[model samples]
Target: MSSQARVSRQIIIQPTGEKPRKDRPMVHYKDRAELKDSVARAARTVWPGNARISVEITGHWSACTGRIFVNNRDAASFAPIVPRTAPETEAFDFGGQAS
Candidate 1:
């Protein structure tokens, strides 16, 4: 006999005033361990201290998607470190290089 289990996790970062970006796609993981690791990584990048962070999961045994929301009071602590926009990168030429 073999065991098969998997879960789809959707991570949403609700900032103070802005609405959650539903356009983003959810991430799938094989187990809870993998999901936890990925969530931690995301938390590090975005200051979840002041926003509403949620994780929705759907899978076998648990067909219904459950949502867990958390509010981080210390979110403002790391506001200065987070970049508002992507850094500018040098332009690239692929069509036979620039003359």
Candidate 2:
């Protein structure tokens, strides 16, 4: 049976090359434009300087009490690469279904 549940939507930003952690979220954005602006502002402040990072725009799907995410290197870009993704994009399920 499927019921309605709040599907949180936020753009998550993190440094790449590090193990994924389920720890509390530190930075998140609800709007793609805002996210881009934030990143741009940061870039202008303290340059990435060889630091690698990734941005994940997630929401509209359930995780089933497990990890679900996607890393799109092809979607990476200097400016707003906005995967042009929609809330219905493919699910990035990294964990099995919850029993």
Best by TM-score: 1
| Among all candidates shown, the one with the greatest lDDT | 1
lDDT of 2 by residue, 5-86 (tens): 3233332323335433332222223344344344433333223443443333344223211111223232222211122452
In model 2, where do residues sit more than 4 Å from their true spots?
1-27, 48-99
Minimum summed lDDT over a 10-residue window in model 1 is located at 90-99
Give the Å shift of residue 99 in candidate 2: 13
All models: lDDT? 0.38, 0.31
Please report the TM-score between candidate 2 and the true structure.
Answer: 0.23
- Native-referenced Cα lDDT, model 1: 0.38
| Residue range 1-59, candidate 1, lDDT tens digits | 22434545344544445675343334444554455445544554554453565444434
